[model samples]
Target: MTRTPETPLPSPKECRRLREAQSLSQADVAAALGVTRATVRSWEKGRTTPRGTKRDAYARLLTGAEEVTPHQENPAPALVGAATGPVQASPDRAEPAPEPPSETSSASELAPRPAPELDPDPARGPEPELGSGLSPEAEPLSPSLTPDQAFDALYAFCAPALVRQTYLLTGRRELARESVERAFQLAWHRWPEVAMDRDPAGWVRATAHEFALSPWHRLRPRHRNPEPPPAAPADRALLDVLLQLPPVYRRTLLLYDGVGLDLPETAAETEASTPAAANRLLHAREAVVTRLPELAEPKELHRRLAEVASAERLRAAKPTTVRWGGEQRARHWTRAAIAFTVVLIGATTLTLRTAPDHYEPPLAPGATVYGVPPRVAPGPLSAEELALRAKLKGETVSGPERLVPEAG
Candidate 1:
């Protein structure tokens, strides 16, 4: 008997890519392979390898996918920078920096072309842009793109997806929109720093996630009221489970599973150590699984997250609006700070002018005199007392006579 050669499975990333490319969910793949979704998830995540018959089946499936779909070794360049790092300007030139592109229409002009155009390959759809879990919809930041143009492109590309993400974090459409807008506004205010940062999209994402999950948001009158739950029962259940999780856990889960960030990237974004991040991710997954056993697989949870986010119309503000708002806010804060400084200076000056030059010792607290009693004033005499006084005056005499008369 001749032994057939075993089909080799692709790498973990390729396994996920091929499945997503086929528009097949983990459940679908699981059903086809006659395994649980968790098994499929582990295979994609490279936690556990398939063995024997299952291994052969998985290998064959991926091999078929590879044959059917065109392989793209280098999927797409990121919007912000290249694989090496951000493209920097030459230093030797004595020329002044180029004027920033016009703010007006910058967003519309530089906005990334729609999904279908930028990423023609369906397999590359879920691959996230620099820091965001969403695809890089915008063109890469070339030397020709001005700072303003680049910022607008980034905002236009990431804002929509970010809004949806924030909604998942907070379950409030308005708060989600506000969070993304606020994040972009801050990003614009610190354009130089943000532009130079390795992951500009990520910086904005962290800021937005922070803002959306802020406990202070509960104090906002508008945010005090919970947003209406998802219309779909399944979506509602998933969102409820997500909301039940601690903010840190929820954010970790969203970043890792929903955004498709690698473990280290998720850890870095969440500001936790890698081990701690892994622990959080585990707890978060367990929590979700406990609530909704159907979402046992990370891919399934990711799909549900996308579904819940998409069901709501969580639109972000225009890039111009975000930029203008940031500027206005900066101006407002600047003016307030200046005014406060002036007031403080004036108060200090006034104190210096009116104050005594020498140090005046504080007066000692008044002491109580040991023997002295408070003064008691005589009150007006009553009628019977007046009569007694008149009688005593009329009967006045020498001391001995008075004593004898008093005895009589």
Candidate 2:
């Protein structure tokens, strides 16, 4: 029997990691590929798919070979910073500078061949340089980003994809745009919190997704027309297939395959456990593959969606107006204080509300207690008991009311 095939390995996120592992910047890759930095950035950001010769060059540059050939022992450098780790002299010694895509490539000058066999294990592949588990949704944010820089960078880099995702989820352009705007506006005011997050884009994305699903956006005034039907039947069919899946699966699919988050970040954004996210991705793929036979491979679905639904190139995000200091800042903090105070009070009230109503029940009413009292039992009153109490006197009657000798 034929063995099952291994999954395809190159993803936009993986490509970014690959280039970073080699310590090559976008400019470096762009220079080598005869493309613009924007193009290289687009590829890494999943904004555009590399095609034909471009794909060929990108694949080779990432592999640190002339091509992404079928081979083992592909070294994934550890995610240690360049300063901390000793350099691997061999990759540099073995590989020459990435040459400008010819007439042909002269980096080792090998004849280009077809796309290589898919690596079965990406986890075993080359690691990134900065740190482990980096998602495409982030870049290292500098401490110096001004208000404009922060908002613009996030908007330019992430808005197109987010809008596409929100569109898919809400099925309305107006709602999607509204959601994206609202999320970024919130992020702008709280850029400190957002930039510090592991997935700043995810913070905004989740907000937009949640906003899109709100009942308010579903109203007719807030709704807008979806894109016109695709001329291609295949594209049309894919949309229909995507819509048929459950909402959870649909959103999960959009984030994982559609938006380029790894399982963990996807889980965080969707509020799912990692395993649940994985399961949703699996089931979503199964559903899509069932409908679209051409997308039988998970990577095919990944490839299709990673190139955002349209070919639009989005510019930086610009919110309407931002007031940075003075009263604006004071108002922000004051509102925050008020909000915190309210939450504190609400929490205290909740604690009070849920608390048991009854006071520690009063020891039955008029109850009395005695510590293991003087050993007293029947038969006849002991000498001590007789001394302590006389029935006629007001002394305590301790010994079980001395057994009475009646007129026998």
Best by lDDT: 1
lDDT of 2 by residue, 139-223 (tens): 4335576757655665655565566556566545556666777777777777666665534555676777787777664466525
- In Å, residue 144's CA in model 1 sits off its true spot by 2.6
User: Per-residue alpha-carbon lDDT of model 1 for 310-384, expressed as tens digits?
Assistant: 667556777788888899999999999999999999999999999989986665679555577889999999999
TM-score of model number 1: 0.60
Q: What lDDT score is found at residue 245 in candidate 2?
A: 83
Predictions in order: lDDT: 0.63, 0.53
Against the true structure, what is every candidate's RMSD? 16.0, 18.9
| Residue 181 lDDT in candidate 1 | 87
Question: How much is 35 displaced in model 2, in angstroms?
Answer: 30
* lDDT measured at residue 72 in model 1 versus the true structure, 0 to 100: 14
